[model samples]
Every structure is written in C-alpha cells, then in structure tokens.
Target chain A: MLPNLVVAQAHDSVMWDYTRKMFLGDALYQFDDRIRVSLPEFAEDSMQVPVSVDASAIDESIVKMITWADYNPIQHIFTYHPEPGMLPQVSITFKVQQSTPVRAAVLTESGQWLVGSGYVSAAGGGCTLPSESRMNDDWQSSLGQIRAGRFSSTDQPGADRYKFRIMHPMDSGLVANIPSFYLEQVELRSANGDLQVRLELSPAVSENPSISFDLLSSDQNYQLWVRDNDGNEFQRAL
Target chain B: MAMNSNEHFEGVAMVFKHLRYALMGLVFCGSWVQANPLDYALTPKEIAPNTWVVTGLTEDFTTQNGGNIVNTAFIVTQEGVLVLDTGPSKRYGEALRQVISEVTEQPIARVYNSHHHPDHFLGNQAFADVDIYALATTIDLIKSRGEAYTENMYRMVGDWMRGTDVLLPNQIQTSGQEIIGGHSLRFMAFSGHSGAQADLVILDETTGVLFAFDLVFYDRALTTPDTPGLMQWLEDIEALSLLDFKTLVPGHGEVTSSTKPLEQMREYLKWLDQVLTDSAAQGLVATEVMRVGIPERFSSVALAAQELQRTVSHLYPNYEDAFFAESF
Candidate 1:
C-alpha cells in the first residue's frame, strides 16, 4: 500500500470513510491516480457545480463506477455501468452541501476498486434551499424536458460526445415540506438501439441536471431516455 | 437572631454599593459601545464642487463592517439632491441620509440604483419615499433575486441588515440624457457586468464626473457571478473610457482623477479572460485554474486571490464547455 501517495493525493475525511463503507461494502480498494475526479475548488453556485470522472486512462475494463460527495446530506451522486460502446468517462453537475471530498470509485474486472477523489470548497446551503423550479408557476410544463446533442470530439477524431440536459428540480427533500423529486434513471443507446451506458441518478444531482459522455463515433444517431422518481419519462434523439 | 439580621443588612448595603459602580460604568462606556457598534460612521467626501461620495471599506462582508463595502454618492444641485446608488442596509441608508443632510439643505429629489446587487440597493428602505429609478432589467432582477440576497445579507452581516427589505425601483431609467437639478446626466446601459440591460453607468456632464458603478472596480477585484461575459465587460470598459469625464468614481474603490481605473480594469479583465481560455484549452481542472498564480501587478488589489477563485468557479465551467461538449 503506497501510504505516502495516498496521504499526498487523497485528503481523507471521516465522511469519506463512512461513504466508502456504505457504497463499496468493505471491498478491496486503492486510491488510483488513473481514475481522475475533477471538480471546482470553490462552489460559486453551490446548487450547480460541474464535475467529471475520467477513468479512461486505466487499462482495465471497468465493471462498475460510483460517485459520491462526502459531506452532502445525500452522499450518493450517481452510479454508472458502461457497456461495450461507451468509455469510462462521465461528466455531470451536482449540488455541494459544503466543502467536502468528492470521490469516484471504479471497480475493474480484476475485482479491485480504484478510487479518485477531489475536494470542493463551498459556502453551503445547496441542499436545504428550495429550488427555482418550486417557485416557478409553470414548472410542470417544463418538467422532464430533454435537450440533447451528439457532437464530434474536436480533439479526438474517432470519438463523439453525447451531452444532454433535462429540466428538473432535483429536490433533495431536505427543505421543509419538499419531497425528493429527481431523475432516477438515464439510458444512452446507440443507433441500433443497443445499450451503451445506464446511469442511476440521485437527489444529489443539480437542478436542470446536465450530463455528458464520450463514445466511439458511429454513422447513426444516438438516443437518450430518462425517468424521474415521479414516473415522468423523457426521451430525446441526438 | 439579632446578629443574623445585622449581617443581612450589611450584605444589602454591599450589594447597593456594587450596583452604584455598575450604573456609573454603564453611564460612560456602555453608551459609547451601544451607540458606536451599529453606527456606519459615514463621512461624505467632496470629490467635486457639489458631489460628495461616502466611501466604504474595501473588504468583504463581515459582522464588524456590516456589509459596508460599496461607495454611494450624491450630487447636490440647484433643484435638489440626486442620489446615485444607496448603501448596503437600511441602517447605512439612514446614516447616509443623515450625512447628506449635514452637507447641504437640499432634499433627496431622486434616487438611481446602478444595478440589482444587494449592496447597491438593499438600502432602498431608507429612501422608500423617493422615486427610485433603475433599468428595467435591473428592476426585474431585483424583483426576482432581491429577497434571496436580503436573506444572504442577514446571514453575512447579522443585525445590520435589520428592517432591510426589497423595494423595487418605481421608475425606469433608459439610455439617454436627462437634466436633474442643473446636472446634465447621461445614462448609458451596459450589459457586461451584471446581465443584459442591468448595469447603468451615469456621466455627469455638468461636473465631468462619471459614476461608473460596479463596472469599474478600480483597485478591487470585481465580482462576476452575474457577468454576461468577459469580452462584453471589456467592451463596456472601452466604451466607458471614451466618455469625457474629469473625475471617475468607481463602484468599489476610491474616487480618482486619473484614467488608472479604466486601464486597470482592461488589464485585469483581459488577464482573467486569457487565463480562463488558456486553462480551459489545456484541460486544466477548475481547482488547478483557480490556483494559478496572480500577476504581480494585481498584488495591490484587494481580494484579488479570493475573487479569482470565485471567478474561476463561476466562469471556468462555461469555458470548459466551449472546449469540451455542448449543453443546451
């Protein structure tokens, strides 16, 4: 166990320990540099902070990927299972309750969990506050509206980026009398209707949740399907 | 029983003696403390013939300062006093009125809010009777985010924000020239700092004094949570510099006669834009971009590092989006 490397790179917190146990279930894990977790140092707008996980550098085939914020009221962010066509890369926006370590854990085919972590400093008040959607009178009309597109990656020729945003409140249920209403499941499919990646989202995701994924470029268009906890389903073609 | 009664009387006498001392202390030090704690100590400085600016501390909001980190000015003319930008809170606004009263006998005829930021207009409660004027977009922004900003202020500065409520500007200020109290004022609307059609810059053609609110931070680091874009801000700065003004009053820093403020704004804004764009192109993470070293030139500017970190958090994601993928 590279203790120095772990101490230098990973700023361990008590919440991270608890989150690790709850998510990984005492599995064998290592703080791996190959799996990179990136987030802003300060959450300027705590309700929506852009973060990403890139485990594409790891040579091993990833079996499962999970991400969580250490100090959020709801620690879980998302869990992703990438099929053959998708890369082990995911970008998302989430709410940060406070300054805490955000981690992305990727389980490989070798049965070892590789964790990447980053810290975000915030003024907090992200979870407890009511969302803008709650105040808008016509929020229902805009709810679950999906806007998505597939663009060719400028840097990488053979890769295409799938980006989508779904109108949602993503309420964490921490505010008074506001129940948890958020996107629960997201599916990305190739042109042939083959499952490329499936994402399980939580209330920890930001309002108007936006996500991105990079995959091998193909001739046909892609499709996105999302469902919220309230059973509202939205579909978009890119 | 006789001895116990005598001892009780002696104890009562001692208590009275201590109470007398406490009363004396309260008469002297307690009055000063009570009167001084909430007082803004606003002193109007005459920057021009009839233009007085009540400058605030160039610092972040604190319980000690009570969110007095903005400059509010007033121009006394033949007709009356035309106020530009109220202070942070009701207490500050009342104090400002008191300061204005001390300088001249003119009543506050009108009020102009430069933008919808809490510091610029939360004190509208003090001038609630006056016909407060602001841009239409600014009025809309205040209507939407003013309550949240008020709540945030109460959390930041505590009791200083007492009785501070959002008061919408009753009149709309458009892009044109207007003569108020013998002062020929030119109102130009700029969308770079806050949002599109929010920031209103005024030029006093009479005194050649330009009130460049929030658009020019002078020696302070600018806040950009609501800024439309850096390029737009740079364009606004260029447009403001072209105005024929002898004295420049920035929204945050000290009043200046030189063009140093405009130069500094251009330099800082271009550096910020360049740093963000290059860092995004290089795929630097937000944390790494925030940690990038500040230029030596900006060392004298207050809150440069802190505001840079905040700017990165607010704007870097957009820059990253330009380089990476697109989100609708």
Candidate 2:
C-alpha cells in the first residue's frame, strides 16, 4: 500500500513525510510478504497518488484483475478489467478528505472481487478550481472548439482519414457552480439520430472537453447533437 | 452595433500597427540573431555541451496570418535533464525526444516543472517513464489545483488543447544549486509575485544561459494573473539585470541574448498593472475596464486593457459586480 520512503511527520511537512512498507509482485493480489492487506503512505497530500498494481503469480485461474485504493468515504474509486487485449493498468486522480485508509476492490474477469487497503495522508484546504479561471458567463451558449481537419494520404490501402473536434464545456457540475445551471445533453451521431453514441461523464470531466478519436468507413457526413443541460438541442454536421 | 463597428475600426488600425512592429521585430531578430541556440533538430535548447532547456511548443497560439509560438522550456544535463518546464502536450514530449537525440543521446534523467501550470507540465505522461523534478509546493498545487484547471480548459477550448493529464513530478527540491551531468544549475525561486507559483530561475554555469520560464514571457504579451504583478516582476527583472548571461530563452516569446526584451516585458507589466490598479481605484469594473481599454500606444504590443481586463479580473475578482454595473 505504501511507497518505499518514509519521512518525518511535522505540521509543515506537506511535501515529504511518508513511505510504503508493502509492495506486490506482478499480480495485484499477491504481496511480496504474506500480508493480508497493503497500506499506502504519503509524502505529499496535494499531488495525485502514484499507484502501482502488480498481479503476476496468481494462478489467474482464480481471479484475473483487481483494483486498489484507500476508501476514505466513497468506496469505489476505480475499476479495472484485465483481458487478452487489455493491460491491467488502473490509474486515476481522486481527492482525499483526510488521512484515511484507502482500499481497492478488484473484480476479476471471472466475476470475483478482491479488496486491498492503503493509507493516504490528506492535506487541508478547499482545493477548488480558482474562480478567476472559471468558464465565461455565456460559456454554455456557444461551442468554442468546433474544429475539423482533413489530411490526404495515398499511402493507406483503402481508407480516408478525417477527424472532427467539438468545442464543449463538459462542466462536471462539481464546483459550487454559479447558479442557473443549465445542462445540455450531448451525443455523437450520424446525420440521423440513429447512429448516436451517448457518453457518460461526471463533474470530474473538465470544462471544455476535446475528444480526438477517429471514426471509420464513412466519407459522407457525421453530426453532433448537443442538448444543452437545459434541454435546448443544437446540431453540427461534419 | 455602431459601437462595435467603431471598436472594430479602432482594432483594425491597431492590428495593422502591431503587424508592422511584429514584422520589424522578426526582421531585427533575423538580422541580429547571431547565436542560433537551436540546431533545428533539438526540441529543447542546450546552453552547455549537454545541458538543455524545455521549450513548450504546441500547435496552438499561431497567428491568424501565420507564425508559430512555442509554449514552455526545459534545460537538460547528462545524468538527468533539468527541465525548465514540461512541454504543452504529450507530443511535445515526443518532440523533446527528437531534440535530445540530436544532442548526446543521454536520457532526460530528471525534469523540473518551472511552474505548476499544465502547458509547462502537461507533457508529464511522456516523462512518466522517468523521474521528473519540481518545487515541492508546486507539486502540491499541481496535484490539487492542476487537474481541475486542465479539465476546465478542456471545457473551454476543447481537446485541441496541447497536453492533458501531464501533471505529477517525481521529486521535489527547494531553491539553490544542484550538480547534474557535470553541469551546475542554480534554481532560484524569486518570490513576492505569482503567489510563489511562477517565480523560477534556471542558470546554467556552462553556457551562461538564464532560462526563466514565466519569470519572463519572451516576446509575447506579459501575463499578470496571480499574486506577483508588475511590481514583483519588475524587481525580479531588476535582479536578473545583474546576472551575466549571454542568452535568455523565455516561456512564451523569443530568445534573447540581451536584457532589452526583458525590459520591455517589465514595462508592459508595469504599464498594465498600474493602469488596472488606478482603474480599480477609480471604481472601474470588468466590462467597463475591458471596454474603455488600454492606451493607444500599447494597443498593439501583446495585450491591452483588452486582455489585461480579463487577467485583472482573475487576479482580483471582487471588481466584477461593478464591472457589470458599468457595462461600458
């Protein structure tokens, strides 16, 4: 659970003050020693926790993958899946309320859940995104990042490459947001709403969200439907 | 509509004038540019034989007309590189590898994020394979406030934004000197400005180059959003004046071998900071401040009240209510 280096605990030591006594081999479940649970230590409370998951020597016949973390309040920090094409690496940035025991609940591909625990030193502060850096007042009214690029390559066998970018403030609604909060639901689709793809997001997603992923096979047109959190729908076709 | 038209008229003239000056600066740079600190292959510049600096270059910040603007910097050494800052994107880190390959092929052992901002450090994933470096407090701030800032930026500008999730540094150190790869560098953290966030100094004894990230904004318009404004930066500029350096590579604008550009940035900061200070005293608030605008002379440089008003708003938020009331 803890990293290797330990530090002197003082009120002023926000940066360096902790260590990890336990580590695992390749598998996330098996600790080097036969310890029941692994605990994480802290040198700094503000930075995101650097996590390492090892699940090597498991007969793997029992379980494939597992998740780890200190469960301060919210039990579920993250979930990971290890399969043929998947490398079981689970890393996420989360907030800690206080010095608490972090835990990881792993659900194997075989449907078994294994739990591990860790300790993280927490910092005190209302770590909110500064107001000055907040979004523009009319941020929701317009899509600021409407972008598209065309690249022609004769090298590829039988494929044309095109990418589209949409300007969206996917406000996670986490901050003590300024009022009149209007949420316009958004989706990706073809010219018709039939080929729609709905994305799941939380307040953790940043304000302006830029997703650069490629779509295949169609040379015609693609559309994006942004239903304002307020329900007003807008559409852009590329 | 008429007023906007009038502003456009004024803005057009300002744009023309700035274009003229920018052209002049480019020509002057072309003519007097004796020290070609870059080899066209190295992504970061090397002050000494092996030492290098991070240049945060992104695909963004281009002129509507045509020109490229680099984002941050890093200075490297042999055992590990003393990065001035992380680059703007993951690709920037990839680009950095190209630069390192041009030189001695020594691995970038360590990175120092000049400030907590992401453009300077968003390329962290690229350096994830190695040990990165930065100020202890900065690491904390970055860990806490950095991602939120990034999320919001993605919200505002979208994915075209350079680096994402480039937060996190491997090690932390206080101000002073460290010996790495045979080069000695003094990491001076000048205070009283930028809320202890941006005041950074990278002095390479080998090449006599001072790599100051946001402590200097190269040839671009000066940024004064947080604690340290013109006054603190002015003092910093003055202090830097005493240092002997043959060249200076900044966070935003151009590369310099002289103090002249730094002086210009100082003047710009002073001018805007003073104007905003006086204007705030006079009860001018947000939009009005943006509306009334900057001086005619400086309307061109980098920013005017046009940009500064938004900046001052962030640095000083209480001024907004009155800003809305004034409504230009």
Candidate 3:
C-alpha cells in the first residue's frame, strides 16, 4: 500500500465528502478517496457513483461481498464471491442520495473484514419508479417460459442465443414504503439435466429481472425456474 | 328585413351555420394548443456560440424492445455545422434538420458519428449530402452490424431511406485533436459499449460547451451492454470531468451546465467495478452477478434498474472468467 495516499477523515461539505481515511483491514470502496477514480474532483454534485474494490490482500478466500450506506434503508446491494481459484475484485454502479459518504466492505477469508468510504451527491430521488410504486413492479425472473416447454439450441453462436427476459420488480424496499412487496429468487437448468445455475436474489437487483448467460455448444436443451423470497418458484426451458 | 316566413327561416339557418363554424374554430384552437408529444421539435439549444444539443423524448432502447428512433444532436461552427449524431428515420433526421435550419443555413459540413449504434447513426441517409465521419472501428461495426440493422430498418422505415447510400466515414478520427470550423475539438476514443467508440468533446477555443455524446447520460439511464467494458466506459466519463468545459451535451438527453452528472457517472462505475471485483473472488457466475443489483445510491437514475442489470450481465461474465484465468 502506498503510504503517501492522503486520508481525508477530517473534512466535510454538503455537496461532497473526501474527509475519510482508509485504514488497513477496512473495506475498500471506490470514489471514496480524496482523489476518486474517474470522478469530477470528488466534489461536484453528481448522481451515479461508480465503485470498485481490490481484496487480494487477504489470505482466506472471500465468501461474499456486500455494500451499503450508513443511512440507506437497503443495506445490501449484491452478494458475490469466487467459487474457487477466483480472484476478488468487486465493482458496482450506485447512486448517491445526496452529498453522503459511501462504504464498501468485504467479508474476508479469516472471518475478518475491511471497508472503504467516500462521498457523493444526489439531485433528487431517481426519476424512474416512484418510491411507492417500487413495490408493485415485477423484478423476479418469470419461469413462465420454462413451463411452456424446452427447445433445442440453435446452431449459430450470435444468431441463436436463447434469450430469457425475467420479470421482477427488485424493489430494494428502501424507498418510501409502498403497498407492494419484493421478488426473491431465479433458477436456470438444462432440459437434459446437464445445465443449471441457482441464484438467491434480493431487492438489490434491478426491477423486471433480466438474466442471460451462455449455454455451451454441447448443451442441447435448457430450463429456467424462479422463486420469490416467499418461496414461490418459476421455471422455463429452451 | 324578410318579408315572408320562408325568408325568416332562411335567415335563421344562415345564423346557425355561422355559429357552428365559430364553435368548430374554437375547438380547433384548443386542440392545437394541446400539441401531440411527437409534435414538439427536437429543440436544438445553442449550447455554445457555435455548438448545440437537441433533447427530445429520450426512450430507453431496450424498453422499446429496440424501437426508439430519434433523440439527435448537432455541433455548430462558424466555418460550417458538423452534425454529431442522426436520429432513426429520414423524417426524424429531417425534423432535426428543420430545427437546425432555424439557426444557420451553413451546409451540414460533416456528420461525425460517436459510435456505431443505430439511434446515433441510422439517419445517415438524411445527411447524405455531406461527408460522414466515424472511427475506423465504428466503420467496421457499421459494415457488419449496420448491414443487419439496416435490413431490419428496411422492414420499419425502408420507404423513407430508400436508395440512400450508407456511406462510411471518409474521415476517420485517429487522435484526441481535430480542427473544425476554425476551432479545435477533442475526439476521445472510448470503447466500453462498442468495439471502437468515439466521444466528441467540443470545447470553445472561446466557450467551453462540450457535446459529450453518449459518454455522459445525465438524468437518463447510464448505458446498455452493447459490448463488454462498462468499467472502461466509466473511466472515460471520469476522464471527461478533468477537462475544462463548463457545459455538456449528452448523446440522448438535455444540455446541462452542471458537472455533477460526470461525477455521478464516475461513482456508478466505481461501484460496479468494486461489485464485480468482489464477486470475482467467489468465482461467481455471470448470471449470479445479475441477480445482485446496484446500490441505492444509483437506485434513482431514470433507467437504473434495466441498465444496471444489463451492465452486470455483460461485464461480469468476462470479468469473473478473467479473474479465474488471471486473478484481478
């Protein structure tokens, strides 16, 4: 680690925050530094904050990665971890509610932790979905197509990529409380019982679930299944 | 005065007809005042002394299942006007031109495409009279991707762009600098979305308005995964903020004097980069990352949910695999 990286733990402003110093064993979050990466001097009022972290310093394998703000109602953005022989670098795109400090912490191998913090500003709550309507939107993958039946893969690579547009309203549930609820899970598998991947999701994902991954040339048929936090399940295949 | 009952009846009939005409006129005026959403011009606001950006009904490309036609732009210059990007149809491009003519009649000296996407380049036929410009990479994509896209457009607006020669850029942008209309402009190559994309930064040798193109999506969705480098795209946006321009014209949205969106784009990139990196350690599959969305800090951007999902899908697959192969 460079000793010269200055820490701004003492300063504070309404539009930005570059006052926090990163300590050893703390979560390393992006755009939280005094001189943030790819930002407008870390001071200008802005919306989305691009964040990244490097966790190679730890000895144990990382099991999960999560991010949250001290003030946000939704504390977990995404949980990702390498299966094995995988490197650890967690990056995400996020918004700043206002001139607020942001944090990123890694759940390390030794059951220990590290986190980094920075600041950004928000003009208004995002204009996409209203905080109240956030609940009513469908954000979980619709296994509706899976039930329609399975089909064979096309011969060409780009020409015949089987496409699945999952429906979910990933309401992070942090916006003003709405009358609706959130989606929970999505699953995909091969029709021949060869291909499958299970995903346990949260509101941290986007609304109207959209999930796509490649099926190797050999995989003949495929299936997709979904479930909400309420244990509801949906399945589709191609 | 009518001397007979028949004459009186005819006079009344004439009065009724006149009143009906008056009522119809009033209704017409009221309806005209309520203009259709499509009726509004893609108003080209003069952002700089010689530059302008047109903001219209910015539709999400994916949401339309890829049917949005126009949200265009222009780069005005005293020497001549260089239209940056064109809309979907000739009519859309011409509508853009009609609004453009409201300012100067300088020949549309050159049309420089920032990338190869159809929304930004399909209306090439409308500007057929001028030399078109694009990156060498963009030219290659248009040849391959554009051919397929054009065939698709043939089904949609073929009659409008019939016999229109789809010309490649006679001039390819190679460096960060170019001289246009006697003023210097910077063309930076950013390839996170397309294989070879260009973001044209127009700075006034006098005024500092920048036609940022798609590099900055203020108040709109960030980006869709047309390619594999969301992180690099974020880097490009951050790099733009270091520049001196005070005003910016995004590819699909309104012109803004604020530098805040650039910063916002940066933060969003940083967040995505970190999330992907963290996932890499666990060997998370690309689909797994898709289930996990972006943070609340980004929850507010207009199309954040859809874009966040797409960005994750494109970047994480390569990212997770890369880390497994080399360890990020």
Please name the candidate that would achieve the greatest DockQ relative to the true structure: 1
lDDT of 1 by residue, B1-328 (tens): 4568889999899999999999999898988887778888989999998999988888989999999999999999988888898888999889998889999998899999999999999888889889999999999999999999999899889999998999889999999999987889999999889999889999999999999999999789999999999999999999998899999999999999999999999999999999999876655555557678889999878988889888986787678667643322
Candidate 1 CA-lDDT value: 0.87
i-RMS, every candidate? 5.6, 19.6, 16.1
Q: Runs in model 2 with CA error above 4 Å?
A: A1-238, B1-80, B156-163, B296-300, B303-306, B316-328
> Mind giving the per-residue lDDT tens digits that candidate 2 earns over A164-235?
334444433435654322223445555544553443222222233322222334454556554545455555
**Model 3 segments more than 4 A misplaced:** A1-238, B1-40, B62-71, B151-167, B196-200, B224-228, B279-288, B322-328
TM-score of chain B of 1: 0.90
CA lDDT for candidate 2: 0.49
Task: Give candidate 2's error at residue B10 in angstroms.
Answer: 56
Can you give the DockQ of every candidate in the order shown? 0.14, 0.01, 0.02
- Tell me the lDDT of model 3 at B4: 96
Clashing pairs in 1: none
lDDT of 3 at B137: 78
Candidate 1: residue B107 Cα off by (Å):
3.7
lDDT, candidate 3, B122-187, per-residue tens: 767778778888888788877777766666565544455444345566677665777777777776
- What is the full ranking by TM-score, best candidate first? 1, 3, 2
